[model samples]
Target: MIYRRFGRTEQRISVFSLGSMRLVNVPPAQAQATVEAAVAAGINHIETAQAYGHAESLLGEILQTLPVPRQQLILTTKLTPQPQDQLRESLQGSLTRLRVDYLDQLAFHGINLPEHLQWVLQEGLPVLRQAQKEGWVGHIGFSTHGSLDLILEAIQTGSFDFVNLHYHFFQQRNRSALEAAAQQDMGVFIISPADKGGMLYHPPQRLQEVCQPFSPLEFAYRFLLADPRIHTLSLGITQPQELQTAWAALRDPEGGWGNVLRQVQQRLQEREQEHLGTTRCAQCYACLPCPEGIHIPEVLRLRNLALAHDMTEFGQYRYNMFGQAGHWFPGVTADCCTECGDCLPRCPEQLQIPDLLRETHQLLHRSPIRRLWE
Candidate 1:
């Protein structure tokens, strides 16, 4: 596996870092096997977050069993910075959960909002710097699901050591963000290059054509890594087969992408539609002022993404990370819709409000959510 310098840090992060959020959240034994396979395959970087249920704890058990030296590993973890003061405690708690003392990289988790980034810079970064001084964290970074504009804004900060953002064949809006990360000498880590499980199986034919000579996965990975600014790619691996597949795919990417494209063509049929990810919600949020305190736009965004991109887990992740926890100052759910039909006109997509709400409610509260939370 090729490794790259993670920003200015002394660590050489693997091009493929083990993501413990998805696969292992379902079963500890399966998670262990996946990590073992990655380690045996020469993967050195392992990333998880304190909020990711028991994935962190599972990795700790595996590390103790594996004979992998502590110094030989590049561990990255994150903490949500809402109650900013709790950021320190969160980092320490993640280390304790992972059975590590000092995190190789401690990134601010889930700052998809520009105001949040500003809040983090003004409030959280100082605490992060203090952690650095205290030797609790080696480097600082953030993982985002925001627009390219917010990403560019974060890159311009000149503060973060790395940038963890999303990229996929269907989603190239962040190309500029990748460029800015390179210019700033910050490590650009692509999170969910497969569109949060959307591209893993196969992508639409039109997308395939644009991403010619590449699978949705390879096209996404290569597209992001093509930028010298990018340092590593992280996947939410859950099984040993996936572990082996991603590593093998990247070994010689030039040819593998084409192979993947052919596989996509053989495996899935393509359908054409304009407003690919926006037919439902587009996340425009133009329909604010809901009498009930529900985050209609945000919920719709996840729904459209879940269906449009086939991100089977994104709807669950969004609910787990946002809904279950009242992180939005005040959060809302589908039950609040009241079938009022008031939001229809304001919706840019004019999606079927009640029907979509029913689906969103079902997806958000599904039993499988336990898979992501362990």
Candidate 2:
């Protein structure tokens, strides 16, 4: 397993960190086996959150029986931004549940709105600072599903040691946030790369073809790790097979995956160009602020992938998440587009904005699915 120094924290974190969200509904024995397999495969960093049902307690029970010493593991947990008075109780509860005295990192989980940031800065941060002073926490950070502007603002505060956010092959809007985190020397951990990275775990045939010699899932791993700014990709595994699949992708064989990585990337671009021509969504967010609250760039991008790469399932999965995901994926579907011509004048590509929205709605709309987080 490849390990990288997690920015200013100086902890050598495995490129593949275990995320415990998927294990919430799994049996304890299965969860323990999965965790044990990950540790055996050299994944030192394991993260869980209080919101994940029974995950902390399950991990605590497993950790005690593992042959590996506690010091060798880098354990992290998150708490929702809470009242100052509730902070101690929340932190202590997490620690007690995880069978640990101090946490490697404690993040303000899901600061996805502007108000959440305000709470973190004014109220949440002070209590975390006190926890640090008492040696209850080793480092402080936050996980966000907010906009790029909000993420940039949070990094600029210089109060965080690390950050957890989403950045993958299909969603590159947060690329600038990765750069900002690097500038601050903050540890950058990607959230849900496999499942959220265009649902590559069960990728369409066209996507598999474009990513030749590597499965779409493997390609996603290589794509993220190519950028040194990314410290780790959180793998939310419910079974040991998932971890093995990811580990196999990380292995360097003979001449290595470098040549194939470039080829696969070029093929992916070329395939999209074949169908999209020049009208492909650049994801520049220039066509934003839709009058009806549509996420134009994301919807159009999903449309591009679905039409060009046969990623219809991925499109449906995300498009259906419009109203269901709340702030985590804020926006209505293109069915809400009012065609005000407001975004038309702003677009640098000068594509017919309303027409594209209508097409997107036609191509990807589906019955809403329950958000995995919920």
Instruction: Provide backbone clash counts, one per model.
Output: 1, 0
TM-score each candidate. 0.70, 0.97
Best by TM-score: 2
1-65 per-residue lDDT for model 2 (tens digits) = 99999989999999999999988788888998899999999999999999887889989888899
lDDT of each: 0.70, 0.89
lDDT of 2: 0.89
Return the clash pairs for model 1, or none: 23-238
**Candidate 1 accuracy as lDDT:** 0.70
Model 1 spans with C-alpha error above 4 angstroms: 82-85, 195-199, 202-215, 254-374
Provide the lowest-lDDT 10-residue window in model 1.
268-277
List ranges where model 2 is wrong by over 4 Å.
Answer: 253-257
Q: Look at candidate 1 and tell me the lDDT of residue 87.
A: 73
